[model samples]
Target: MRDNTRPLSPHLQVYRPQITSILSILHRMTGVTLALAALLLTYWLASAAYGPEAFGRAQVLLESWFGRLVLFGFTFSLFYHMCNGIRHLGWDMLWGFDMPRLRITGAIVVITSLSLTVLSWLMAYGHVGKL
Candidate 1:
C-alpha cells in the first residue's frame, strides 16, 4: 500500500516562490516585528514616566545610528502590516482572488507601505513640510 519511491507531498524545494506566497510570509513576519517593536515603545514610555535622567538616556539610545535603524525597520514593518491587512480585508470580501489582481494588489501593498514609511521619516526629520 505504501510506495517508498514516490514523495509523500510537495516540498518547498519543489516549487518556486511567488509574490503571493512571499507577501503572505512577509505579512506574518512583520506582525511579529510589530509585537517586538511594541516592547521597545513600552520601554520608551516607561523611561519618560520614570524621570528626566531615564528619559534622557532613552532619548540618547533612540537617537543613535543603530537605534534609528531599528526605528526605521519598526516603522516599515508597521506600514507593511497595515497595508497587507487591508489586502486581507478585500480577500475576506471575496475580491482580488484572480492571479492578475492578486499580483497587482500585492504590488500595491508593497509600494504603498514603502512610500508611507519614507514619507513619515521625511516629515519626522523636517525634510518635508509639517502637516
Candidate 2:
C-alpha cells in the first residue's frame, strides 16, 4: 500500500551535514575498508605459506608505491574504525547523546585516529626510536 501522493524523503543533497552524520557514515565505510584490508592480510599470509616464490611475489607487490598507498589508507581506516568503535560502545551504554558531548567525542575520535596512524607509519619507517 504505497502512497503515491506523499512526497519522497530528502536525499543527501537536501540536508546540511553534521558531525554525527559524518562520523556515522565514516564508521560504516571504515568497517568495509577494514574487511578488505583483512583479505589483503590473508593473501599475504597465504603467499608466505606457499613458500619463497609466492612470498617473493607478494612482497614485491606490497613494497611498491601503489601498495604503500593502499597500506597507508588501510592503516588510517583501521585506527579510525577502532577509535569510532569505542565511541559507539560508549553510546550503547547511553553516554554522550547530547550535542556538545557528541561533537567533542567525534573530534577526539578523529584526532586519535590520525595520531595513531601517523605514529604507526613512523614506527614502520624506523623514525620512532626504541618504541
Candidate 3:
C-alpha cells in the first residue's frame, strides 16, 4: 500500500515578511494570547473563591520572574492589539483601504505599540525604583 502525504505549500522561504504582513500576523497572534491571559484573570478570581492559600500561591506565581516576563509580553500584546484594532476599525469605517495608506497605518501601529510598551514598562519600573 502506498501512503500519500502531500507536501506542504510554500512557507516563509517563499515570501519575505513585509511590515504589513508581520504586523497583521502578529495582531492575530497577540489577540489570541490576550484571550488566554484573560482566562488567567478568571482563574485567579476562581481561586479566591476556593481559598486564601490558593490565591496566595497564585499571587506568588504572578510575582515570579516567569510571571513578570509573561506580564510584559501581555502588556506588549495589549498595546499592539489595541493599536492594530484601531487600524482595523478605520478600515471598517471605509478608510485606508488603499495600499499606501494601509502600509502607513501598519507602520504607525507597529511603532506606537513598541513605544507604548516601552513607555509603560519604564513608568512602572521608575515608580518601583523610587520606593
Candidate 4:
C-alpha cells in the first residue's frame, strides 16, 4: 500500500512576517489578553458587591502602579482588537485585497490603535486639559 499522508505546511521560520500577518496575530493575542482583563473587571465588581472594606481595598489595588500598568495593557488591547476587527470586516466585504491597500490598512490599524489608546488614557487621567 502506498503512503498517502500529506506533509505539513511550512512553518513560520520559512518566511519573514508581513505587516498583515503581524497585525492578524496581534489581533488574536489581544483578544486573549482582553479575556484576562475581563477577569480583572469581574474582580473589581465582585469586590464592590462584597462590602465597603473590600471595595476600598480593590480600589487601592487598582490605583497602584502595577494596577495602572495592567489597565494600560487592557486599554491598548481593547483598542487594537477593535481596530483589527474593523479591518477584518472590511476584508469580508471584499475590500483591501491588494498588497498596497493591505499595507495601508495595516498601518492605519496600528496608528489608530495607538492614537486611541493614548487619547483614552489621557482622558482617564484627566490630562486632556479642557478638550
Candidate 5:
C-alpha cells in the first residue's frame, strides 16, 4: 500500500510561468501596492487635519519629483489591480474559459489598464482630456 499523503506535485521553483501565470502574479502584486498606497493617502489626509505645519510638509513631499513619480506609479497600480480583479471575477463565473478569449481579455486588461492610467494622470495634471 502506497501512502500518497504527500502528492508528487512540482515545486514552485521548478515551474516557469506562462503568460496567464505571469499576469496572475502581477495582479496580486498590484493589489498589494494599491493597498499600501491607500494607507499612504490616509496618512497624508490625517497630516492635513493635524495642522498647517503638517500639511505644509506633506505638500512639500508630494510636490517633489520623486514623490510625484511614486504617486503616479501607485495610481496606475490601483487601476491595473481593479481591471485584473474584474477579469478574475469573470473567470470565477466560468467566463473567458477558451484560450483565445482568455488571451484577448488578458491583453485588453493590460492595455486598457495602462491607457486609462495615463489618461487619468493627464487629466489630473490638467493637460489632455480626450482620447
Candidate 6:
C-alpha cells in the first residue's frame, strides 16, 4: 500500500523557506551553540582553578585568532538566542502573529542581536566606554 518513490509527507523540498521557519531553525541552532560555548567557558574556569600554568595555557588558547573567532561566534549566538527568546515571549502573549508583524519582528530580532554583539565586542576590546 506504500509507494517507495514518494515522500511520506511534505518536506523541505516541497516548501519555500520562510522567515518564520528560518528564524525557528536559527533559534534552535543558536541554542545548541550556546550550550557548546558554555563547555568552553567551563574549561576556562576549571583551568584557572587547576593552577597558574593551566590558566596561562588556557589564556593563550583563548587569546589566539581562532579562539577569538569562536568567541565572536559565541557572542553572536548568545545575542541571537536572547533576542529570539524575547520575540517568542511576545508570541506567547498572542502578539506579532500577523504576517507583516512577524516579518518586522524577525528583522528587529536579527538587527538588534547583531548590534548588541558588535557593541559588546567593542566594549570588550576597550574600543568603547565601559557600559
Q: Using lDDT, give the best candidate's number.
A: 1
Each candidate's TM vs. the true structure? 0.86, 0.87, 0.79, 0.86, 0.83, 0.86
Superposition error at 50 for model 5 (Å)? 0.4
For model 3, residues 33-120, the per-residue Cα lDDT tens digits are 9998999889889889989999999989988999989989999999999999999999999999899998889889889999999999
State the TM-score for model 3: 0.79
Instruction: List the lowest-lDDT window of 10 residues for candidate 1.
Output: 7-16
Q: Candidate 4: give its CA RMSD in angstroms.
A: 3.8
**Model 6 misplaced regions, further than 4 Å:** 1-10, 127-131
Ten contiguous residues minimizing lDDT sum, candidate 2:
7-16
Q: Could you give candidate 1's per-residue lDDT for residues 1-131 as a string of tens digits?
A: 98899977546466789898889889989999999999999999999999999999999999999999999999999999999999999999999999999999999999999999999998898953554
Candidates' C-alpha lDDT: 0.94, 0.92, 0.90, 0.90, 0.86, 0.93
By lDDT, the better pick of 2 and 4 is 2
**Candidate 3 weakest ten by summed lDDT:** 3-12
For every candidate in turn, the CA RMSD to the true structure comes to 4.4, 3.2, 3.5, 3.8, 4.8, 3.5
lDDT of 4 by residue, 1-131 (tens): 86668656545567689787778779989999999999999999999999999999998998899999999999999999999899899999999899999999889989999999999988877863665
Q: Candidate 4 — what's its lDDT?
A: 0.90
Error of 3 at 111 (Å): 1.6
Residue pairs with backbone overlap in model 5: none
Off by over 4 Å in 5: 1-12, 127-131
Question: lDDT tens string, model 5, 37-83?
Answer: 98889989999899999989998998799889988889789888889
Best-fitting candidate, scored by TM-score = 2
What is the per-residue lDDT of model 6 for residues 1-131, given as tens digits with 9 covering 90 to 100?
97799767547567789889899889999999999999999999999999999999999998899999999999999999999999999999999899999999999999999999999988888953544
